[model samples]
Target: MSITAATGVPVIEPASVPVLELKGIGKQFGAIRALHGVDLTVRAGEVIGLMGDNGAGKSTLVRIIAGNFPPSQGTIRFDGREVHFHRPVDSRAVGIEVVYQDLALANNLTAAANVFLGRELKRSFGPIRLLDHRAMETRALELFQELRSETRPHDLVKDMSGGQRQAVAIARTRLSNAKLVMMDEPTAAISVRQVEQVLGLIHRLKEQGIAVMLISHRMPDIFAVCDRVVVMRRGEKRADKPIAESSPEEVTALITGAKEAA
Candidate 1:
């Protein structure tokens, strides 16, 4: 029920303070309502699977959380404090990191560059400032080592495999010391070996007490790591339960809106 951090930090589960909580989360575009009354809770050191069919409002909800736009009809609570995300910067400032399927790495940049991205370290020389590449690379290597990844810090993202790119993307979150990471379809298109690596990386994140929101259609991926699942259908949350008490069949039925028949 409790896990220690990667550096042996005693991780408090945030039992009284969930990392993120949503209530009556709704989104509307013109006359079309994309989401209605959606509720979700993400706890520290836990991996939560967000499963829903296409057109099920999963994307809408994620965008809202990522600060793509403000929710039209709900409240967001982070670390027991009420908050509003009007822009992506606001979300990032609060240690909320979202890694989409694209990985979002600059293809031409080195893994270390991408890890720091906009928040690069600088060295000063008589009022002149330059990027401290060596420091960034060293830090990047340390992060990868902590994740038990074999990725090279100086390697170009374009040259890396899909799984390797994902590793770098996930490492970027650690640069900001993120508390919660939302992975959108993490294992969509990758080799079997790559999938295993990414799944192992998720376990590492959880061990470090970083809450994870894993949004994937792959049942095996969900079952492999998720502690709980929230199933959505037609823009509304249909079921939320612990992994131990819920089966893939039950989740599938809830997602497909076939619960009654099943």
Candidate 2:
């Protein structure tokens, strides 16, 4: 099936049997239609890049997948089964975690505390509930080591570098056994060095057999880490193709809705 972007929309190819599939997905807000007949699929062990210009419905789509908003019309399927996600918690229960561009981290909290923020370990002492600080710290350190992350569990998030904070976020998601991680412009606010580190982390995520949906406008990064590219335009899917099959120029044309001469 093909997804065409409207007026200013891009044209992207479609993938096969995505681990996550949105069939004829759509969302409407009063008189404004945010999305229409959009279909998408993400497969395991693949980094699918979702590219689009501003107002291209990328955020809307991510929100829908992340369960921030339910689609007004369409069916969402995960692992070949139809599923309804009413909230972010529902998405998490199904192993879908989203890391927004903001890299939501509590600056005042230590790395360990930030990583295990909501799901902290606890101990029971004869009717008294106690936070298991030691256990949490130990597991946080272990998780960092497993990811080859250099940040210390005791490091204050405010004192850590941008990349370090990013690492903490990713580690937290992994700790929750996330099967699919959606990163929105993960490299947006970091230094060049940190961008490299994040790219390496993305590759590592795939190696661990976790599917990733990366939303970025950086063509080089897309070509570098993503196995396939899915472009969106004007609230619609434009193209979804293997990285090797399409060139940067071709993809750009798709995004801008510039048709090639016959």
Candidate 3:
């Protein structure tokens, strides 16, 4: 920890540990070996940029971590304990959340509805129970405010911009108190302004001490928000370096095989 010279205020690093650890993680679909000996660790509040070319096993590794499938070999340790996840729920049960590119939102629904889609708030009236619209709207409003987003709770998702949709999706993760969030192609095809908003939201998550794994092909987005960059090529990790020590040129080379490994 260091103190500011001018203000004499102490700066404390956020306490962190390896929230997710993958050791010798591998996968195979029949005879096709999709991943081999891939090891990774994401600590609390760390933002990792995962970049690679198409068919570079990025998706396969993410799917394995997301519990879409079990690894063919190796073990996954979450919060310092070994875990074997058979399905997505098992991962979610342990505070893992994924925000896919599609956002998986109900277009016709309000932002509040989308935020609490599967985990809706309920109100009981003696023998009757109903969806708690007022409570949900109140909570969703608070979440949007926490993210510093202008998205209104009652606004229909279809009428919202790409960035607002992202806000709602991220709010859901916050609602779940997710320890780690893996976002797949979050900034893809979004406008420049919207991209900035999404990056700001990522910063907010970091400030709140949530680990984020951002999977994207966009180099600027990675450099702008990530603390570290992990590169993969042909189903193997090629580089894992601090973002300050790795340039886009180096990452591009690692992805395309111009440079072997780092």
The CA lDDT of each predicted structure is: 0.91, 0.87, 0.94
Writing each residue's lDDT as its tens digit, candidate 3 over 1-262 gives 8898999999997655599999999888899988999999999999999999998999998888888999999999999899999999999989999999999999999999999999999989999999999999999999999999999999999999889999999999988799999999999888999999999999999999999999999999999999999999989999999999999999988998999998
Backbone clashes for every candidate come to 0, 7, 0
Writing each residue's lDDT as its tens digit, candidate 2 over 1-262 gives: 3445566556665555567888999999898888999988788898999898899899999999999989999999987889998999998988899998887899999999999998999999999999999998999998788777788989999998778888899989987889899998998868999888888888878988899999998888999999989888888888888999988998888788893310
TM-score of each: 0.92, 0.90, 0.94
lDDT of 1: 0.91
Candidate achieving the largest lDDT: 3
Error of 1 at 203 (Å): 0.4
Model 2: residues with Cα > 4 Å off, grouped in runs: 1-18, 260-262
Candidate 2: Cα lDDT at 10:
62
Candidate RMSDs in Å, in order, are 5.5, 9.1, 4.3
Q: Which parts of model 3 have CA positions greater than 4 angstroms off?
A: 1-16
Better of 2 and 3 by TM-score: 3
C-alpha RMSD in Å of predicted model 2 compared with the true structure: 9.1
Residue 83 displacement in candidate 2 (angstroms)? 0.8
Model 3: how far is 256 from its true place, Å? 0.5
Best by TM-score: 3
